[model samples]
Target chain A: MRFGSIIKVALRALLRNTMRSILTALGIIIGVGAVIAMVSIGNGAKAQVEAQVASLGQNVITVFSGSMSSGGMRGGWGSAPTLTIEDAEAIEREVTGIVGVSPEVRDRNQVLANGLNWNTSVNGESPDYPDIRSWKIASGAMFSDQDVRSVAKVCVIGKTVADQLFANGDPVGQTLRIRNIPFKILGVLDSKGFNLFGQDQDDAVLVPYTSHMKRLSRRTNISSILIQAASADVIDKVQKDITEVLTQRRKGREPDFTVRNQVELAQTATATTQTMTLLLAAIASVSLLVGGIGIMNIMLVSVTERTREIGIRLAIGAHGSDVLMQFLIEATILSSLGGVIGILLGIGSSQLVSHLNGWPVLVSTASVVIAFVFSAAVGMFFGFYPARKAAQLDPIDALRYE
Target chain B: MPPVVKIEEIHKIYESGEVPVHAVRGVTLEIERGDFVALMGASGSGKSTLMNLLGCLDRPTRGRYLLDGIDVSQLDRNALADIRNQKLGFVFQGFNLLARTTALENVELPMLYGARKFTTKQIRERAMHCLDIVGLSQRFDHFPSQLSGGQQQRVAIARALVNEPQVLLADEPTGNLDTRTSAEVMGVFQKLNDEGITIVMVTHELDIAHFCKRNLILRDGVLVRDESVSNRSFAATELEKLSSAEAAAKLTGAKS
Candidate 1:
């Protein structure tokens, strides 16, 4: 007999129970669908994390002041004056792989401009702040070292503050009042969207460290220090070197600063999404296994129901192997058909999620192919025992079955 | 030509229960080409067992059997399947047509498993021809559920003949039909027999057995009588007589 006819025969038998066949394949449908949808969403989340990391800065590290203790009462991080501007200069001078360093102090204040008032964060930074944080000046110029030395009241406005303070007008040469201290806007920084913490990054103002300490907050303590490593490969090494230098400068007491690398932070963010994706895929695979079991159960029932028919075929001339192949082909067709439908369902669901949540979702061809092949293998694996049972039936006994 | 079926001292024992039951004991029979023979007995007389053995569906426990010059008593399952496909045809009492299938596809089923390669077109043509031979040319597309009992049996006969086997084995072919339909089915068999196709049938009805050329009676797991029919009955004449009787009965009803 030709192989084509065998397949034709198997297809005809399955068509006899169309509704049951579809219901049987539904298990695999949901399984593969869930698998594809979950994996795509997971991948989209990971990609989003990567983009956020890149936008934050490349090959960068931040050192924050440690928690403080006074009279056995501990305070939270940044509660005391632990890091200073001199520490930033010392790290820049001591570390070999350090490409840039900036001491930052932050305070929230109300700014008055064009007869409008808006509350925004004020940042005190040095000339290397732009290089360390990958900020670009959209217009005019940045504060020079001379401005920091003279504590000149010159500032750079971010995109959000610029839009609010000047609207369509140019704000580079305009003057704004911060805490009743008048400062000239030297430039506008380009827009960078949101950070990993979901905070708007382009909603602050920048000024020379000396001017922010003397004119605005009137404080000497720095909030944090930003460092730029020359390359991503050397970020951890640079962090270690800075930590070692800080500990030595503290005279063998506990270090008053904690150094963090961007690479480690990115990895932490990526690990979360990766875990979620793996967990979803694993759960979906369990349903797929259940679907396979469904196929097996239905196949066993079909074999028993068609016992006499099988006997008749065997008596007429069909070999045992022929009977086995017929059932096997039926199962494979069911699963592959289910797989195709599940793939379409998965893609549709992924699109729906992307639309509803404004999330990025990618359905790769490799994942589709893998899900399809895996379903096929599941069909074959589960269909074997029943087919063998049918093939091994004694014709006399089967024919004599009432 | 050599005998189509030669059986020598074949014994089939069933070890299913605690005590063994011998279904067929020392049954030896030979059926030549073009022979129309009927094996008859009451229930549990081993006639069905003998028929199963003749069809090569079961192996004999004691004796050797040859079918169409091939010793198939000890052959494996696949080898026996090949022999059954190439040389034997079977018709069951239930008509055994696959449900939800058209007559044409039902007739084409046997050829699907034939060792000889045949194109789909050829298989269709040959199936149509066989259905026409059984006088069902117009009902090719009707499913078994739509067909009457006699039409279903004719479709079964067409399926059996499509493979062009050397011998056709039928078990109670007319057990489910009315008298007129039984005669009609017997008429088909008689015509096929006249064309030199060997036939071996099993029937409990002596009247049904009378239509064949010879009768072999089994009793108590042994063949008790093997004799040629002294006065054979022709199914065509019987069918004519039945229709005439029906016509007379209808006339009487009209007069009343």
Candidate 2:
């Protein structure tokens, strides 16, 4: 018989048992839906992480102080003694690829402004800190180099601090109490949202390093050094240059600080997100496999149920291949329908999840297409054995079936 | 004259447990073109087995069978299927119509499967013509469940005739119908035979067998008798006489 006629016959037969057909398709629907939804969630999380990392300045590098031990007892919780303001200045002077550098000292303290009080951490750094870390002054102006040189009692507040303390009023050119000492608010930093560690980058305060050390904390040494390359591609060269410069400046003290590149940080975050996505997708694929088995089981039953019909067709004139094609087409149609429905359901579920939880959920077209194609392939692979059995039946015996 | 169907020393054995049951033992038969023949047998006489072999549905265990000078016994499964499509049409006692399909589509099925060059339009036209021959032209769109038992059998007959095969094989075609419906279906068979279509039917009813021109009786997997039914009685004429007598009795009762 013609292939078109066989397909039509198969479709008609399937339509005859509408409930059974829909039930069979449900397996595929769940399988494909789970795959798409899980992968989209994973992709969305990865994108959110990437966006946070990008906000920290993709071209910037951070070097944190290692632990210091004296008399076999760890020193007090302070900046590493080996690093200093001089080291930061020397790196700035000697490093060839470095565009800017900032020596940082951080401390958590309570601040009061306009009778509203909020506890927040403060970063003590050079005038180059804002540019190197990609922070922009949203209002007013940044503290100048003269402020660091003169130990000026001036600071910049982040948006979160401004929102809590100032409350819709401009805090620039105003004074806020830091550790019960008066400090003038020089500017407000733009919002930076949250980082991968879930810390709000926009909730802190910034001050000149000399003033913070001499006036507030009474400390002299620095904690970490922040540097920015000209672009993302120059980060490696910039790292090597800084390492060499710091080594020479510390009199070759075997590099007492840890320099972390943006590439490594990005890669670590990406690996973690990718592993999560893959694990989720693998678990969902188990359902797809189960769906395949479901199809096989149902097809076997269908072949047995239609044995008499098959026999009659064969007795009339249908070839074995014709019978095989008919059953296979039936299976393909069932799976394809299931796949389409599953895709729609998955997208809908993802959107619903995002809406309910207020979390980012991204759906990729490639993943949807892959899931659908895989479902169809699963149908063919699972439907083959039953179709073969149907095709190989003896016409006489089949006709005699009760 | 070339025979439409020829069987020579055909043997069919069925394996039952440890013993082999002989279904057909050295049965030989010849059926000429355009001859309406009947095979008469009681239950378990192996007449169905012989019909299965003649229809090319089963291979003979031994001996040669030829249909239109082609040795079907030696042919493979696919070749046998081709022969059935091109040369033979079958009608079963149960009126095996696809329950979901219309009468016209059912009749078009064989033509669709056979190696013919006819277009879909031509196939439908031929199917309608065959339904007309069986007096079911108006019921072409009706499903099998919508038709009576005799009408379904007539539809089966139309399906068998749509392919214009060399032989028509019917296994107890009127076995499921009442006396009146059976006579109506037999009338269709008589009319088709008069148009020079060869038919071979299996029947246990003597009255139904009398409708054919020849009869072959089987017992214990062998042909016991083969006779010409040139002067057998027909049930239709006998029923006509009975109905006329009833009508006359009704008139006499009214006069009294």
Q: Individual DockQ of the candidates? A: 0.64, 0.70
- Say which candidate scores most in lDDT: 1
For residues A1-402, could you state the per-residue lDDT of candidate 1 as single tens digits? 578977887788788899999999999999999899999998989999988887777888899998888999998877778898888888989998878888889999999998998999999999888877787889988899999999999899899999887997999888989988889999999998788897888899999988998888888879889999999888878999999888888998877788888888899999999999999999999999999999999999999999988898888888999889888988888888888898899989998999999999989898899999999988898999999999998887788767
**How would you encode candidate 2's per-residue C-alpha lDDT over A344-372 as one tens digit per residue?**
99999999999999779999999998998
Q: For model 1, state the Cα shift of residue B57 in Å.
A: 2.0
Cα RMSDs, all models: 3.5, 2.8
lDDT of 1 by residue, B1-256 (tens): 7788898999999998999999999988899999999999999999898888888899999998989888999999999888888898888899988888899998998898858888889999999999999999999999999999999999999999998999999999999988888888888899999999999999988888999999999998899999999998899888777767877888433322
For all candidates in order, state the fraction of native interface contacts they contain.
0.73, 0.61
- Worst 10-residue stretch by lDDT in candidate 2 chain A? A73-82
- Using DockQ as the measure, the top candidate is 2
